[model samples]
Target: MNVEKIYQGTADKVLRGIPASSGIVLGRAVVLRNEIFVDTHKTIQNEEIESEIKRFDIAKKNLVAEFEESISHIPPNAKDLKAILQADLMMVEDKFMYDSIIKFIKELHTAEAALVIVFDQSKQLLKHSTDELFRERVTELDNILKRFIIHLSKGEKLSEISENTIIIAQSLTPSELLKLIEKKVTAIVTEVGGITSHLAILTRSYSIPAIISLKNATHEISANDEIILDGYTGHLFINPDLTLYKFYREKQKRIAEHIKELGELIGLPCKTKDEKPIQLWCNANNIDDVKNAKIVSSPGLGLVRTESLILSLNRIPTEKEQYDYYKTIADTAYPMTVTLRAFDIGSDKYADNLLIHEDNPALGLRGIRYLLAKKDEFKIQLRAILKASKHKNIRLMLPMITSLEEVIQTKKLLEECKLELLNEDETFDHDMLVGIMIETPAAALIADDLSKICDFFSLGTNDLTQYCLAADRTNESLSEFFNSFHPGVLRLMEFTVNAAHKNNIPVAVCGEMASHPLATSFLIGMGVDELSVAPSLFLEVKEKILDSSFKQCQKNVSKILKTAMLKDIYQSMDV
Candidate 1:
């Protein structure tokens, strides 16, 4: 039946959230009720610690086996899932949790209560730990307690469900969700989760529709109600009218078609309608991302965030290790360019080992400032990049350089690093291209001078817009002012791009703004040399370039930048 013929339903309140992943799919609602069990304590003699340990051992073995089985079913290409499984394996024999359980058993003498205390302590531990490994370990421990509670309460095994169900729950531990590997589970909806929560990451990896932070989701959603989930819009509908269903169904079809077309376009050069070549680059964080880029036929790596590598290491990676990692990408790309941004740490992404904190991290010591404070660490990274450049096409971009003085100071440090390498008789490329991120208004204003020293400029519009408008993007209260389409922001960007061009320096955009299709044309029209976006968006943006003309984009940009009102600008530009 056509959507036009479907009966209309009463409008419901619409809630909004950030779309972490993009897609459209409609499936049956499989409401998952989170099973919570109370722990009972039993007193055991100290002599029984060994016996208790044995019981714990057996439980862990069974749990590990279950998790392994689940991991085996995950596609080999699912790096995110594999990483989660690795975390589970790392935490399987957690010494602290096991010892705590054993101690509780010996002191209180009750296995059941000891198990309860262990589970509770584990949850507390997970709360304190930001490492995905530790969190996954806690999830594993929680699963054990859940099953034990179920068996103690004489509850039935979790019912095997069909694939088209939307799994609803108060919270889902990674282990529990992974175990339900039957393909029928089409979507996940949880009442609890932050933006960076494990469930959110899993949902993104699986390409499933999810809604989190719904305080009343578990209680609000009924079992098996025909539902529609627009993950792109973060909207959940119960018994949606036929019109809505038909609309989304067609949307789903179009999305599938678009993805297929993009896949086909892989390996082809990205060119505009006028045959002007635009560099289509991918943002990569690690070796896995580099590998994934090749799979999607991305021509180059735009931004290799070094912070991810540093955070993953137990200690600071040696210069050699860093060089190897950088070299791998450089060699792989060969002739293709890779712009590795210097560690851009601040706010939510600082190295734990460094222990650097600030009153307001966003505005405080971060990016090049933090690196400058720790000169030795910074030099090691610089030397590594310089050495790697000997082998492949690699360019350096400094992050958060607010003034030309910072750029001058950074170049001095680079010179010192180069001298040290030379003294060590290290044969490396000293002619590597160097650039700076134009993220702040001050940087944009001084772009003319900065362009003289730097080889290129990359406009980080995400932070540029935030700083220019004096509004934090993360703050929902000031979202109105955080508009990227604001005339002020576009003017600043235009000025920076013009400044870079006048100096014969190419300018690229590697911000979230660049990923928007509407903004993509505007950026091209503003004389952006390249567009660095998420790998998923690479081909789509390339397609838009092929379909659009520079003249039309220039006209759009002119209209957009004329209006002071963001909403009016967006409306006029059809954005």
Candidate 2:
């Protein structure tokens, strides 16, 4: 119901900008801006100076954390984001700059006010610089700090965003763009960011329709304004006429036809060329995804991200609230089954009480670790999941499992929840399955032991590859090293899959590896019992396996397993 049909989408009044990505898209607009304007100067009381300085220090620390979080979002424009990020820090740490800020704070200005004065003075000095690099850095520094200011302002604008939407911003960062991409934002327009800058080139690499350097785009484009963007020509039209509307609407249909074609394959029997049946499941985080999965006729959900369903409010949801939410999806996919993973918090995500500062969050308390640490909250979650299992179709999955000891501990807790539900006379499924996500090297290394104690294993290849290769995708220096097809990563997958099968348990590839074009057939050959992917790519992945003979896939897997180079991995799976 939140979805807007793009067929009626159009644009009338035109505005010119720099074409960043080459594509055409029509959709509604969502304008993003900072809640606190940078230019505002607030005089602080002399007595409040101490607290103000502390606030500034905290904000500066948060600024660095923001930059670190952007690591995973480095774009095509910044081929070496690690170095670029270092340069950004050096600019902020300049002696004269931080000194000027302190000087302003002594003059009784707020932290943001002090920053603005120093920033303007610095820019004035560089205004006439003949060095092109100096001129460019000035612009980069301003954009980076302004975004940090927005963070300091703490405005997360309405969390409810719909599909086929275009984002217009005073300025945008590659990290911001990546987050929106996850929500299926159709296009982008921004007042700042150059065609060669990090934000612009990223849009190009992602094949999204976008334009940059559109002056005052955040003001010119209002929210919900139906607009047409010609990314090839750097033009945006607002409130388009019937004629232009019809033209773009027809073009939109032609473009969407290919995607629609893919969905048609979903209803067909899923199997390999040899008639070996395989399960193709879809992943969902909300109602829209559930609806899309239903349309594609996904057999069931392989991953139900419970956090996304509840954490948008950044608070702990009540047990009834969690039950209603999970029950909706479980009932919708009834007959088939839905696997609801417990709140996988940590990293960039937090749920109220779970919010805490960590120098390295990704490797810190997250996923099942967070849940086990917060046992009372964990019980509320388990009880809700159990309460929703009245249809006998909802299962529980634990993420970030690193040991059989953790599995035993979780199993003990799950049993407690089941008993509580029975004592309360709650209607529930007693046979609900519990599984562990084999994401860590430690977990995969002990998959044989885990299989003996767990109902199933879901290979979270994204984390597995990162852990196995000791590579972080955000660190551009390790771009080549952060490969999903690295031999070691693949070997781990094979080892875990074999362990699960030998123990008479099912194994699934539920990460991006399942949906990768080359990896799909190879995974099929590797003998994973199921492949779980986003609903949008469900049918396409299913078709990839259907076109592959099990024998050929087995052969491809055999050849690729022995390859030493990345190029050879591709060649082995080339056919």
Candidate 3:
């Protein structure tokens, strides 16, 4: 039911949060208390309005100049990092955002208050989005605003960080993060960062162990205090006892050695001890994911969620825009397979118009049901995916599919789009493989029917675990109830794999469980052909997989599945 590593020794305290990166590190805690600013009703005098507007303009110009300088200093090889900096710069110079701020300033609001109005307005709109990507955009924009405030407040730049310093911060701006990377801070702990947030993603790209969403991080961990950060397990051991300190010290040493060897795994086939070829597909949700996972040879993107690209521009993108965006992704991971899962939006994702209020939208209209209900809109996405598939490596996957009919209708629409493209003489992959996500209970129950249609089956166990258990994983109280390794869930996974195999189709686990360290061996035993793992977890998952043998894991699965208790199932996989 849980994979957190619990040490048997005492420590001053161990704080648990979500891991942003993966590694074990012992460092001097360097508390970074950035000045916090909030929206206020403070109004500038009429005479101060023009000066405030000019101050705002000057701040924007300075921030833009900082991004440009950073981008320039970036070597030619780090194109992705440079591109990220450029994107932040674009946000700094966004015309609409700038104009709105100016209008607020003209209303006599101070430059700081003007920023608050504009940033809050934009963030509030995106917060209503059901998509995680859209919600994460709020964090990205928050960083942009932080930069602006720092410039306007006449704040000093970050001081140089010494080696092996664990950064404890309230929240980090993008520029501060870049500077920390330059200084090579040992670890990062932030009070307000989600796993998908910009700060967390950037930390992982640099391979620094990070614990985000760690409340009271700055208050508890003072500068120069010795600490152990467990990014692999989401625990921060602050001022630990001697025993705990020694354990983590050795643990850090072992992890460093393992990470060093993981680079050698690049270009090498991921086969188990028994020589069972294990296909590890990376989840390329963003450019950073692609860049981090690009080290692996012939790296296939198991899941490419298109929610951000669809919703980012504040309007639904044209087919051409989607094509250009998707094509760049496929081209970046060129020649390697890219499984494009069409918008999995529902009330839980970005479905503003799809549903107003339902008792429960997850169980209601979402996924394939939502797409099917909006065929015309769905066709646009389908055509864009198809058009982007001219590379011949792109395949389509349907999310939240529970029926044979949904797959049939989706395929029919896809064919119609293909015909339209053909008529227009536009190039696309006619033979692109189509798949379905086995995330619903009904889908698993009728895997035989679904397998008959789908070229592949990707078990989205994150949702499957939630739906099968009838527990909302997001609901904190339901945490203990949402166990993915439960026998019932295991049976569904086994059944789907069997069905896919019966139809001679591949089955990939594209859910959180796929990359989960404890579940790696169990999944390998269950006979899933591929695991679409988070790139950040790639090294750790690879290490576990290499230590496992298919025959041993299969035998273990047979014994583990026969047990009905979740505790026993987890205990068996704990090894």
Candidate 4:
């Protein structure tokens, strides 16, 4: 007699992966269980050692060429892929990895085993390293190995474990993850990573449902097991009951409908029901993001982070390259305003061979300080922005400005750059507007004085809230004080906006605070002229603003300011 399986056992020790993006997907699990193998050709005669070494050299050259060729075909629109290729090339040329491979080949007596041993050892080191910097280095090394392996395996028999699969692996490098086309792989689940990890960022970029840090996911999930993945709520159900299945099926239908509705909003004006027009803008890091902004009908680009371009290149981008990049976005946005912020680098984002230890990096030497210290580099960026402004609507903004003196010095530097350009007969937009980000309390309090010199102000509430409340949002222990609606924060914002308006300067809010549905109304009432948020949240925020009244927001702000403590203000307001 034959029997059919109805249910599987419960996953008692199952660890769940953190969802990076949202969607429900069901598919067979493809287990890419990789094992190192050594392919040894027949032993060459003693006299062939010189020829063997030459062959290994040729193989290395050909391998690198092949990788470059494949990378060239990756869409220029894929910023994540571009970043991975940049990092991978660095790894291939790293002295440490190269020396290890050479030593292995000389001692191990075969090129194939030598390569495998070097890769295996590097992988082991990556798994064991406690230092984050070392771990990142190892991750890059593993990327090189995986790419080389895949390059060799091309056109060969690839064991397809299943069709319409979800990839379950220990951890996937960016290159490996990119190689899997979206149609075949429904989702990606890994055993390690936080939201900022490369794989997580890439998954979010592609709008794919990904779950990370699921310990032993590869061991627990069996091939071809019908499972339900809830990316929104980070839930996984294995062989769910009939009732649960029906509920998820209904949920899938609702999600599809909602997405369709959001699609309809594309290219529509982001105006409130009362005819209050809000400038819906997109935060971009590269030209691809600029293109995405056009698709979403973002009226402008709020924050053009230039760090992505700098990090992707082997060396700092030349003035001409930077000019072209900035110009591309400005020309694309055309009449819409494009605000480009100077490089914001510090602890985690330090340039090569320049290290600075800080007890609290968020408050340490970053943003303007880093830029000022490297005057030449800072001037180059300013020159690029000035040149780009000649063709498009461009605004230059300084980040992490805490004092009036920093603003004065930055303005002076800009003047010097302008004068130098004039001497070189290169015409620039001398009348380009300059702005400063009010992220610190000191900056907020002195906005009146700063506004006298600067053209505009943008409130970075993410750091401002953290600084005011003396709470690190990353620390779960301080979760109670991370509230943005707190009386203290609201009061500061009110003061900053009032100060800017008092001096006849426009103010905008560009942070997580601006994207919140309830907070958007409050900000507009606080006398802010603009609210810049991500493109994905544009329609929802617009809907919220249309449903709300500016009059009510002002009334709520007044009530909150009268309260004594931050917590009391939050309790009084509905938000």
Candidate 5:
């Protein structure tokens, strides 16, 4: 792993990490730091106020221009990063923020100090945000502010990188990543980040090969050392031998071919070989989700995770804020429906404000239980969803409902929220369909009763499977037991689907089960009307469905239901 040894083309090889993006690359290593130091706490004299404000304005313009320039260089399919960059751009152009900073400057705060004060308030709030994802955004925004301050004070710039360079670092903020991207950096390796991190999202958007959470990556990787990055597999081969090089080169070609095939299926309907029309939708966390879903011809958005918006901004959004955010998704999806799920808050999503603590958070006060107790917060969200439904096709969905009583109470609250909106003369959709996620065993078992009140049912199989099996999906030690395709889990899905259909309601599978190609056939066979998944897996699942006959899939599912063992189910699928 040393520089000399790597150069000699023989060293410890094959580092595994989280696959952040998919692609293959062979290049020399380039190291990067996560942030640039800046003095952001200085005060200013009255005489310096105008000049300082001018300086701040100039830096803001420059940063925005840089971000806009970066957007042009990235691939068109990289809509996620493009939307993110546009959001940052919106923040830079925020009139209220600008006025506040100018006011601070007039009050004798230095330009940098004013900038720090304004953004620090947002950062502090984000620190306590519900989801860990938004907390990560706080750090990202901090790095961005620091970079802007550095640009204003010292005119600092990114380190120069040569072509075909793979960036290795302890961490990378989106701003810094873009800097390297401008120099045509080939790939990236980071020691810390997750699938939802800005770095991971950006890499995927840009189609860059990236592996994250490779512990001690900076310590092991040397500058200018030859490295092979297989981001699809989360493998990094250092100082690879000729044989290893040839193996990866061939692997790259196969992956490229597979992607090309998948790409060709875009815009095609997801109909089975027997001509049964199956609806394809996508789960979305933000506006980018709607954009991606539309690109893949997803007829609608199955899940618009509202909690992410709350966490990302670090607070419960105001009616206006929520309206604007939801409207953006509605606008993006246009005539297509957007199923906005109510916040399924829990201790696990970093919603400390929602719950104090629970010994077993998985089975604790969460989902509908938490929302019911916090009626005011629940009302705010419901009202917002109703208002957004005025503009585009929208369906309001309640998450984590485990009983008929919860459904009844939620409907009552929905009526109350609608009445309040009517009193205020606020425009909203009065007839928007309200659905519930059948994620709990209790919910699935009693789905017949719940479906009577619900307009639709969307299966959250990820949680349903874990709850049914009484296993934590995240617990590596219990990994063997966290089977979503278990006979018991499949039976619950079957039961829920039948219950919805019995009531003449449409049911969609919007969980990880639907995204998997192996499970796609079985789910189709089981009479699932719709499948909602990540946009990246759309074509893959579509291909599976197109090659299957619904009648055959029904037979396969029937065989699975009668089977007693997990091994037998796999044997039936030839997995």
Candidate 6:
């Protein structure tokens, strides 16, 4: 089974996967693929060297101008798009890149060959990056370089777009996405991508409906085929009939109204109708995420994945480098606590330096286990976190801990790093709190014991659901089994919250469940102290919380836990 087409409607010609962006639009399909392959080893004559250099310089200048022009045309709301385009501009103007390519050109290589060689070196380096965002940036770089190659070769660039175009592609780089936005494309459907992909992020920022990871979307749909893309539900209908089109058209209106309603709730406290205060926090993936969290009035930042910094640079960042990144986030979210989870790599993300092959990677070396095994790497990250603790609002959190012993060992290791920092007469805030993620079933069951040692417990519902249900969340066929609302998973959540509160430790849920409307009320009812979600959904989830009643939710939860059948639970909860 293809994981990309994990979700689909009963209709025969519908494709689905992850919902990258929300909204609905009906437009003609416009398949796009902008791939440029070149032979870098091609040699050139001595006389052509000077012309080659001139051509390279001219193309480089044109590419930079093109990127700047693209950025200038992007709507003001698309902040990330502007930043990405600016980065592309910088890449084109990079001094080292020019020097390296010029040197290659002087060695009797064509300009195109030189450009490809120099860019390939950078690509090879970034190919090992474990961070998805950085990898997406590399894809954007690839697109820009390809455009440069096309310009130098005097070839045409990407195909033109038509009005009301619904782009169908195997994948799109950020630059391609920006180009689509510039063309006023209505929607995007891709064969491969995820929610965090730059293309997906850009689509969402541009308010363009997009469904990605729909396996073979380009092959399945033809050009000018009437397409209805429902990005909110992750479904794309090829040549949809009038009935389906009308249904989605109505849905689009309702969604727009609902979003407007949610926007009104922004700046309001995340409290139940009965006046129960619930702390709302945003999960930060980068500096922009932190900024969005601030905009959404998120009380604090929860679950900042620290591995991204290393992945983006494709190297184990030095202590100072890591410290700087953490300090920036901490300062950006000043007066608000920033909980930084130490490198949660392995399993889904494989760093270049640390390569481990496991048949059952999910259950194997990942998260805390990976961190513990790589003590040197762990120590460096800890030192960086401790150094950044000087901001006072910084908190350290450990991921994938299935045992209390792991928590104790991590604390001891943190102390060792602290002692080393002290020996060097470095200043750090030792008073910072250390939190642990209750992700595994073992961790949830022993939440009581772990709470005794940790300051807080962050329920990682995504992994916890997978582990509790004994189903791989990434497996398309087992999607039904990987339910966060499963009785067992819900019971574990309830138990963890109870245990954490019993020990006077606050429990926060920083997972997809917290952001989901269906699960938000139940989480609040379960006595979850904090709800952390994607910054975009923070206001909507808060709106749900504000509209809910704690007492009613508690009552509903009691009935839900008692219900034995999943269908009955769903019917009762109206989810």
Q: Identify the leading candidate in terms of lDDT.
A: 3
Over all chains combined, what TM-score does candidate 6 have? Answer: 0.74
Ranking by TM-score: 3, 1, 6, 4, 5, 2
**lDDT (0 to 1) per candidate:** 0.72, 0.75, 0.80, 0.70, 0.79, 0.79
lDDT, residue 320, candidate 4: 94
Order of models, best lDDT first: 3, 6, 5, 2, 1, 4
Poorest lDDT segment (10 consecutive residues) of candidate 4 = 1-10
- The TM-score of candidate 3 is 0.80
When 2 and 6 are scored with lDDT, the better candidate is: 6
What are the clashing pairs of model 2? 11-240, 12-240
Kindly provide the TM-score of model 1 when superposed on the true structure, using C-alpha atoms: 0.76
**lDDT of prediction 2:** 0.75
lDDT of 3 by residue, 1-575 (tens): 34234553466666877777888888788888775566568887899988898898899889888888777777654454665676678778889998998898889888998888899888776555544455556777778888898889877557667766888988886677778878878889988765556677677667778988777778877888888898877888877888888888898788668778888776667889999999888997666567667866636999988865654554567778888888888888877899888887765443456456654555667778888887887999999888888879899989988889999999999889999999999899999999989998999999988888889999999789878998755433455577787788999899889888998999999877887777898899989999888776776677778888999999998999799987787679763
Query: Model 4 over residues 325-437: C-alpha lDDT tens digits?
Result: 88888988877789998877653353462556554555666789878877888999999999889864899989989888898899899999999999988877888999999
Q: What are the TM-scores, per candidate, against the unseen true structure?
A: 0.76, 0.63, 0.80, 0.71, 0.67, 0.74
Compared with the true structure, what per-residue lDDT tens digits does model 5 show for residues 1-575?
Answer: 23233334444565777677878998898776544443556678877878888898888888887777876766665555665666666667779878988888888888777888888876765554333454565656666676677668756545567777898987765657877887788899988775557887778767788998787788788877889887755778888888778877898888779878897788677899889999988888766667778888888899888876764564678878988888888988988889999987765444446456554545667778888988888888888888888874999888888888888899999999889889999888888898999999999999889889999999998779878998755333455687888988999999999999999999999976787656888889899999998777677778888889999999988998999798888878755
- Model 5 regions more than 4 Å off: 1-18, 28-162, 167-176, 189-194, 212-228, 233-267, 346-365, 420-428, 465-495, 549-575
Poorest lDDT segment (10 consecutive residues) of candidate 6: 1-10
- Candidate 5 local Cα displacement, residue 238, angstroms: 5.4
**In order, what is each prediction's RMSD in angstroms?**
5.7, 13.4, 4.7, 7.8, 8.1, 6.5
Weakest lDDT window of 10 consecutive positions for candidate 1: 2-11
lDDT of 6: 0.79
How much RMSD separates candidate 6 from the native structure? 6.5
RMSD (CA, angstroms), candidate 3: 4.7
In terms of TM-score, which candidate is strongest? 3
User: What does candidate 5 score in Cα RMSD to the true structure?
Assistant: 8.1
